[model samples]
Target chain A: MTDNQRLYWRATRRLTVGLLLVWFAVSFGAGILFREALDAASIGGAPLGFWMAQQGSIYVFVLLIVIYCTAMTRLERKFGIDQKGSDQ
Target chain B: MSGPLWSWVFVGLTFALYIGIAVWSRAGSTRDFYVAGHDVPPVLNGMATAADWMSAASFLSMAGLIAFLGYGGSVYLMGWTGGYVLLALLLAPYLREFGKFTVPDFVGDRYDSRAARIIAVICALFVSFTYIAGQMKGVGVAFSAFLDVPQNWGIAIGMAIVLVYAVLGGMKGITYTQVAQYVVLIFAYTVPAIFISLAITGQLVPQIGFTSESVLPRLDRLLVELGFTEYTQTTKAKIDVFCITAALMFGTAGLPHVIIRFFTVENAQAARRSAGWALAFIAVLYTTAPAVGAFARINFIDQVNETAIDDLPAWFETWESTGYIDLDDKNGDGVVQYRAGADNEVVPNRDIFVLANPQIAGLPAWVVGLVVAGGMAAALSTAAGLLMVISSAVSHDLMRMTFRPDMTDKQELRWARISAAGAVVAAGLLGIFADNLGFVAQVVAFAFGLAAASLFPVIVLGIFWGRFNKQGAIAAMVTGLVTTFSYIVWFKFVDPDPAGWWLGISPEGIGFAFMWLALAVGVLTAVATPAPPDHIRQLVEDIRIPGAN
Candidate 1:
């Protein structure tokens, strides 16, 4: 309900939506739907689509998570909400 | 050392290591038992999570499945790993903020309803037990192939090992043991893969070998020459692939065992960091798996085709006796003929190739021994994690949350251990008879869909949507379960008709559609119903902030 909380939530939604779209595009779009079309091209002697499905997509997924983790951590710090309270 | 000797040595050493770790970090309290006292460092927790997540199936069978299915296997590769993104971004931080012992704890409190918690417990139990049975079966199969033991004996030994660690050490023992298991299993997986890759393509890294011209193009040409689908050709329908991948993604994020690992971390930042590390460690094996699959297929064909029965390797006969390799000379020919069609005389059980890969490539006996230990590690670690979830669901959710509110930590800790022991024994029995009970295999895959349809959407709603009341939560679970459960049972058992599949989406892919369907139904029902109580809304808002601590 506070302005700061509202702003943080909105920022999170923006980051999540943007990242999810990239996730969808890499895994679903190139990996499956447009696979045949992309297969005409190649990566490291493997077809791009096949590479995307088996190797490239997985690599990208990890990168996305790392990016999200760092960005989210920064976002937390920006809002002055980053805390490391000890557990009971 | 000889073959069995090497196997025994590696297996003995790993078993001793696990038991030693368990004894060193024994759980003394309920907190230590459940979430390892919430003091685990992020990177170490990540290693433990990686071990807990990659089961016997991933260790033994995923590469084999990829080999046979070719490009169609993309669904699994994308499905399993992609979900970690969702977990890190959507679920882990909020759930970690909630800081509970189990998934039901969050559901029960967030919804302010006992019914919601009970349903969550049921869903968690069903998913975990379904998954655990398969892990048990995996343990048996791996042991029989590598150790010359009967499947039942393998299951029993696995049960005893899990009993010592999980029952005594609880999650704390399981956590440290899993870190050790991760190192062993990853070393076991990658060392052989690297050797095979070097032999085949002269590449040190298997991922590079997978994409190299020597492997993919040559493998495709060889397969086409032998009347098989080209190795890289797309076989599955695009829509079905999309559906299965989505279903698995959501299902992985929803998994109670995986989700609970995040709770073991110090804070939300640690949870996010650990998710990244877990996926990185898992990707170490997953990325190598396809390369291993491709190399194994090539090696398998070369070893089988046009070879005389007497000329076949000794390992071939060994695997054949275990029923993993069936080389029936159907045409009464002295030479073995392995092709795509029915006349193909050599039909190796898919998993046999992975086990036989080292031998086929002429690796030393010690490598084979390492693999046996690796497979056992993968199976046992996952089984321990699932057993923890089962015991927690029974003792924490069903007993303390629902009825006995005044139960002390000491008493609950005892119950947790008791239930864990009970679960391992029951799972061992299921493993022994897994083949006869055909539905156990079906239920393994069914676990993901059930989680996808029921718990996944509800948990997401509980954190993100404040007004998602108990009515909507109940409705979503019921509708999700009813729809996904019936569809799987119908297609998998009764009909078995590909043409009759709804939109040609297999039961594996059906979870994809139904996840969204359940989410929509949940949202509509929640909106139509009276809003949830004010404190429940406040609780949602509280967990949304990572700094709430």
Candidate 2:
């Protein structure tokens, strides 16, 4: 495979893994199993579990994807991938 | 709450704004009508997609489901958002790369058959209609709760509003309006939750507050003492739980309204980015759902229980009067406790939690007004998006593709507008006639099941497997629809027992399982018969290149 192809694959794979980890941490870890345990931690005067389930996790998800988009765009440029439409 | 003549004025202004936005962003051509001319920014597409997706079900029903179901209900939190991962990684890029005007267009070209497109159109209609009926009802419920109007009138007004915007702007108008709706809904959903969390648990965030030790220690223990599972435990049966989660996950991915969002982006790469962005946006609402659900359940119980029946707060009396909430106080104790399973004697409508949040949290009138607007945003936004999908499929996919190939773009656009209006009228009538179609969640679930069964298989096979033919696509789609619809009917009305065992599973799960089976069988039969020609592979190659346009 070309270096560009390899770079694209690696960047996507890493981001996917990272996103999944955060997803698991918030939904499964904080939401289900360790909910009470995390409640021990507090955010904005709220317990960690409640915060994670309601607001914090969602905030994290949005930030995570924004990061992914930025990084992926950088990857595209590095690999000489031109994604812009010529139609316009 | 009554002093809000100004609130009503604000609502009028919001409505006018929506109409203005629709007119301003109206699609100019067939390409714009179909895919917003594929110039939408990834983030904007993401936001629009999120608004389109987080319907009355997500905005209104989900938090209550999580609150009642507890840990088992986390399935929605996981299942719906998790599917985005699947979409981004497995589906979005590929589908976007293979750019087509409609989902049926993809299926037809990929399978090298017009018959496939026809079958796809039917499935999309079934899916869109089943889902749209519930959205219209949701708008009525929201209006009735906050605006103090009769539900039938609320539904009619809601239908008219959706028709105006959707028919006028098509995809472009719908896209921009959805972004506004997403902002309104997310804010409306979280603000009350935060206040309630602080009140009950001394926490600002509802998500964390549910998990934290209760601010009132006795309340937590009391929940466990009253034959209720721990606030954090999973009490539901594993099999049923798994099935519900799987169906919701697959259903989200399969839904035509949601899938069509990808087409708005310029190319496959943008589509991938948009999917990620949409999920991220959706996650904000989804993750909070469980927290809101749990916190509402706890707070609601805390307020009602141990209080005298006559003294059980003014809102309860009002809610009871409206038939939205009922309190029997079965043990003759003034307090009400809600438990899982069908047998649980105490029942409260899940829809009320979000609607009642302002009163429950003791927020100001303005906040309550905001909630009203938010609920409208959720209901109307989804309704408008679905109307566009249903209408476009009718005019473009079925009419133009099949009946009137010679029709100009201008003529087609007119038909599309007419179709949008007709769909809204139909939905309004259905909402009026099926007055007892109570929960939006159940109705939306039926739509999801229909989509999963019928369209998902055809879409998947047509894209990946080159050998799939028209005959196979038709057979698969029909089989899927029949199996799913039959399962739903048999369970909903015919038996409701589900004990005699068609694979020892309940009816809801059976729909999804049958869908997968039908798809497999359809593909196998197609493969066994004959090889597809070279054009099929060529179509695949065309969709693969990033600069297809």
Candidate 3:
């Protein structure tokens, strides 16, 4: 791989892996694993973990995708690869 | 107009509108039929994908499941929606960059093996056919309950509507039609939710009402008093919940109908944005659904518990007539009781909660009609989307790629239409005979597990691991299908009990265990075997970036 493409790929991988960890924490972690512990607190009127499991995690999923798109766009611009032509 | 009359009016108008859209968007070429010529806007494609993904199960049955499952129901909420995160970040953009018409196209090319492609075709067909049968049944249920159409006749009508568009317009037609359907089904879901939320908690948004201070505490206490688990408490094994949600998330990301929608967009950039929009559109219903469940449950219990038969609300008899909700008055006190034990005099089927939610809350006649129309929109749009996948799997993947490499585009289009029509007839028969088959819900849910286990691992590894060769791909698919399919049949059909659950994983959750197994097997086999050819590695590298050189 070219150095330029490798740099861009590394940054993209870091971003994806980090965001995926957050996704896991919310849905699988807070939503399921730590749910009982989190239930000691509440959000609005819902038990904290219960809300995360059913409602909060879904909202976060939406946000994470938005962030991924925005961040990827910035990466493309930084790498100067945002043009419309194909390598082939 | 009265309730039934309003139903007729809405169904008539929506059906007319869908048919009109199908006519205008009819596909003239294989590109138009397969991927809408790859010019769809991100937001529009997102909406269409949402409509395709939501299905009759999401629109008609989800809230009812949530109503009963309570806190335990987060598996559907989190598992299904969370998959999109994986799609947007890891899969959709990359697959969109690959610029394929079908998932199997990518598999066949990436692995450079027709055998791999045919296996993918089988996986796609299995999931789509199983999934479509339930949708046709959902269509039938709404038609019979709301429009007074006989069940068989209802399936026939639903099949015909799907056939007109899916066979005629193909992906292009299903796209715009699904966009329209998304609007209808979302309105149908949220309007009733808003009404119930307002009536129950004086809140406009059901999600907020469900979260903010409301009637849930009293509902929980009353449920416990009636010998039930707490409403917001986990009643199932936590591991079962965990595994089921994982399987569903992986399955959703892997679903062919959903994956193919990305190729309808212009580029990978649009694919990412579309995934976001799809989730946002889906969240409209998913976030509101739990609230609908809580509200519907509270309303249902209040209306039935200790109410004398003579004084029972009108909806009681109405729903009872449909056999969705029944009152036996078993104690002979002429009063109905809905408790957890055998003494309970009410059988509130899941359908009654969602399908009957509007009437249960004393909504207007027009609202009931609107909900029925919404249910039909949800059912048919998904049916059409699945039909697209089924037809393309047979025509594009099986016919052109494998058997008839020299086939003309014109012949391919004709065959595509033929396959779609055949699928609609088969799906209709499944729906018409769903009762004797008697496992619609079980089979539809099992599709998720099947997709998760068989297709998800190979596709994900195909993109990320350049060395994932055809041998590894074939091994993964065979292992995933055999393990997941046989395990589900063994547990769900042969001996249905928790005693047989492996490590607290239910049949639906078996996919979670097997997905990881498929991934490991694929990776290990790829390493142990020869690496892929130079071109396949290069294809993988090229798909990772837009302006690769």
Interface RMSD of each: 1.6, 4.8, 2.0
**Candidate 2 regions with alpha-carbon error over 4 angstroms:** A1-81, A85-88, B1-7, B215-220, B329-346, B436-441, B467-471, B501-504
Best by lDDT: 3
Tens-place lDDT digits, model 2, residues A16-62 = 67876876677556754576788786654455674554455556556
CA shift of A34, model 3, Å: 0.5
The TM-score of candidate 1's chain A against the true chain A comes to: 0.90
lDDT, candidate 1, B56-103, per-residue tens: 888988899899888988887999999999999889888988988999
Per model, how many backbone clashes are there?
0, 12, 0
Candidate 1 docking band: medium
Off by over 4 Å in 3: A86-88
Q: Between the candidate structures 1 and 2, which one is better when assessed by TM-score?
A: 1
Candidate 2 achieves a global lDDT of 0.73
Give the clashing pairs for model 3: none
Alpha carbon deviation, residue B209, candidate 1 (Å) = 1.0
Per DockQ, the best of the predicted structures is 1
Candidate 2 lDDT over B1-549, as tens digits, reads: 461453465467678878888889988897788778888899999999988888887887888877766656656666677657556654666677776667777777677677778878888887887787878888887777667788899998988888878877889888988888888788888888889878877778765665565632434465676677765456555555556555666677777788888888887778878988898788777766776776777777777766677677776776778787766666655556454444243557887888777777777777777777777888788887778778878898888988899999999989988898899999888777666755444555577677777877777666556677777877888888888888877776677775764765565566568788788879877877776777776665444444433
Against the true structure, what is every candidate's RMSD?
Answer: 1.3, 4.1, 1.2
Please give the range of 10 consecutive residues that has the lowest summed lDDT in model 2 chain B: B337-346
